[model samples]
Target: MADDDDLLGELLRFKLEAAGHDVTIVEDGQSALQAARSGKHDLMVLDSMMPVLSGPQVLRALTEEGSALPVVMLTARKGQDDVLDALSAGARDYLTKPFIPDELVARVNTILKNEGNRVASADH
Candidate 1:
């Protein structure tokens, strides 16, 4: 996860870890980009605005590089364009801020589960 808010970051980390995910929290978008490029994580939960790089910029870079890593946008931007832009730019999901923690966990789980199924089918 990449979020500038320390409290939210820790809260999300706690919640996600409780959901049985091994979570890594980064405070900036540049760190997020570097981590994503490392090919180590299965999914990323990105905030729309951050220091160094915005969520959309990172998403675009990864898309341009043909990276298949799934990204979920967790941001305070509730505008239609924000949602549309992120989805069109290749985000797996776009979730607005002040969101229910449980909902986020559920969405993450569903995405991961679906991705697992896709990979399994592709291997056949």
Candidate 2:
């Protein structure tokens, strides 16, 4: 997961960890990109307005590189256009800030479960 805001990042990490997830935290989109390139991750929870590169920028780069890694964008922007931009840029899910931690965890679980099902179906 990536977010420049330390408090939010920490809170997110804590919540995810509590939900039995192993998470790696990155402070900026540049580090996020590097981690994505070098590691195997089931999903990404990205913040929209990040330093070095915005969340959508990172998603675009990943898409351009043909990475199939699923992304969930977190943002304070609640505009319809903002959501559209993120979806177009390859975010699988989007959530506005000041959200419930349980909801975030639930979303992550659902995405992972769906992705697992897709992979299993593909193998069949």
Backbone clash count for every predicted candidate, in the order shown: 0, 0
Q: Which ten residues in a row have the lowest lDDT in candidate 2?
A: 34-43
- Model 2 clash pairs? none
Scored against the true structure, residue 4 in model 2 reaches a CA lDDT of 91
Best by TM-score: 1
Taking all chains together, the TM-score of candidate 2 against the true structure is: 0.96
Deviating ranges (above 4 Å) for candidate 1: none
How accurate locally, in lDDT, is each candidate?
0.95, 0.91
Model 2: how far residue 120 lies from native, Å: 1.0
Report the C-alpha displacement of residue 119, candidate 1, in angstroms.
0.9
Residue-wise C-alpha lDDT for candidate 2, range 1-124, written one tens digit per residue? 9999998889989999999999999989999998888857889999989999988889999999998888999889899999998898788999999899889899999999999999999998
Residue 22 in model 2: lDDT: 91
